[model samples]
Target: MNFCKGKLRKLKQAFKIIYRQKSELAPTGLNDDLQADVMRRIRRLGPLKSGSNFLMLFEQFVWRLAPVAMTITLFFAIVLMNFDLIPDSEIFQLLYHESDDFSMIQFLRF
Candidate 1:
């Protein structure tokens, strides 16, 4: 729509005005040294934390996390071992237990 196009054009013009660079020997205004100040502040901090630092942090915590993970896994294994995971109890009983009902066997045959 024309309205959207107008808004987009206005946004583009605003961005261009905000980010437009100028090469000059003299300072622009009183805040001319603001960029220098920001750079100095950033340089004061030695280095950014990289992925290797993150891995070392994770390695430090891994020993503490291992016991909890093992506990959960063992608990899950115990629960699964306690129950018959079959869908139908009737089929489970027929397969595992001896039954004396001739009618049920006939029905299964049918």
Candidate 2:
């Protein structure tokens, strides 16, 4: 534990030093104006393909959200099916009671 703490402190100090160096290296007012002038010389030739962009964005969104959706479904299914996991009390049972359309009966069929 002591070794871990010491190492963490050293890491924090190193990060502080690196952050100071990065801030020092950041462009000042005159340099930023000069860089903006340089960027103005670049030219845009063509527009992006909208169909491919929409497809790629939709796929990426699904890939990121699928796991979260599956996890939520699994959690609800487990909680709905396994009633005994809850304490044998009236209020708790009422709070977690399943709706008719999505009850434990429907879950057990699967």
Candidate 3:
């Protein structure tokens, strides 16, 4: 029992030392640099602080426009896929007439 306890204590101490080493090796300055950069960019862009009414209107506009844009994109994609399914004139002739040559009727359709 004493031997087992000693082994557990050694493992715990080793884990603690390893954790401390890793923590020390990490870049401590990175957090401060990241925070400063973010703040600087925000300052350059200027705040959106045109009173509460502007924020409310902007939020409503985003909510309304998002769905409309998505729906328009979906419709265009559907139409494009349909046109793509209609084979080229050469391939269409083969399927329609089971012949390699293009007929007068097919030319008239074009």
Candidate 4:
């Protein structure tokens, strides 16, 4: 029984030494440094663009090319509008196609 009490006392002392309370901890500068490092990383990486896939890249491309696409569409509409619809007296011109080559027509359509 005395040996058991001695072993129990030693185990209690070991537990006390191993599991000290937070208030018993000595101050170290590591916490401040870790906080500063975290803040710096956050500041450096402010806003992240999620363009990691084909659809995301295509969406970004569409947004960037919207103005150009609109301008080209407007230009084509204007050109087609400006072209005289009525057939002239002297010469006849095809509105859309002016080529015999099938590949050229396909390319133009594309």
Candidate 5:
């Protein structure tokens, strides 16, 4: 535990040093014509192909469908729990009923 704590302290000190030194870095200035040339080259390339477009559309569809999929999964989980679809176990019955007669062997035999 002491070793872990020492490592954590070292990590924190490293991060602090990095944060303190970050401001010393200089920013690169881009020329206005350079930006315009890059944009002109991009515009000349035209739109994406059908395959890339399909992938983008599919990505959007999956993003939109994620919540719906999760909702359906949760709904089914709740339904299964409510319906008691899981097999009854000796431990569960013992916990819920405080019964001593239930045996794991008998439960397994069925």
Candidate 6:
């Protein structure tokens, strides 16, 4: 029982030493020189040029337009798939043509 108590006390002391070592090694704050170097590199790069700015603008435009474009494309696909459901009108006649053998593929080609 005494030997077991001595071993337990040693283990507790070892754990405390480890915890103190870890806390001492941990970073307290950022180094000023490292922060200054990062800022210096950013300054050297400067602002974006006209071409880069235009490219960024174009990217944003495409991002905003993609969903709308996809929705319109999907709507057209659905309508085309159910072309027979569309009421016969001037627009339909113009699109489908008055020919007895009207073909969607041929119309699309034109």
lDDT scores in order: 0.74, 0.73, 0.82, 0.71, 0.79, 0.82
Model 4 regions more than 4 Å off? 1-52, 87-110
In candidate 4 the C-alpha lDDT for residue 99 amounts to: 39
What does candidate 1's lDDT look like per residue over 1-110, in tens digits? 45698899999998877666433545666574887888888888757788569888899799889999999999999999997664557665765665564445654674
The C-alpha local distance difference test score for the whole of candidate 3 amounts to 0.82
What's the C-alpha lDDT at position 79 in model 3? 89
TM for candidate 3 is: 0.31
Native-to-model Cα distance after best TM-score fit, residue 24 in candidate 4, in Å: 43
Per-candidate TM-score against the hidden true structure:
0.34, 0.32, 0.31, 0.31, 0.38, 0.39
**How well is each residue in 58-88 modelled by candidate 3, as lDDT tens digits?**
9999999999999999999998988755457
On TM-score, the candidate that comes out on top is 6
Query: Any runs in candidate 1 off by more than 4 Å, and if so which?
Result: 1-49, 87-110
Q: How many clashes in each structure?
A: 0, 0, 0, 0, 0, 0
lDDT of 6 by residue, 78-99 (tens): 9899887545475468665656
Q: Residues 7-95, candidate 2, lDDT per residue (tens digit)?
A: 99999999999999998987655687677776665424234576579999999999999999999999999988986554436534554
Indicate whether candidate 2 or candidate 6 has the larger TM-score: 6
Candidates 3 and 4 compared by lDDT, better number: 3
Superior by TM-score: candidate 1 or candidate 6: 6
- Which stretches of candidate 2 lie above 4 Å from their native place? 1-48, 83-110
lDDT of 4 by residue, 9-104 (tens): 999998888778654686755687799999899888775554346678898999999999999999999999998655442122332355353343
lDDT (Cα, tens digit) per residue for candidate 5, span 38-84 = 89998888776965899999999999999999999999999887884
What clash pairs does model 6 have?
Answer: none
Q: Model 6: residues >4 Å from true position, as ranges?
A: 1-25, 48-52, 83-110
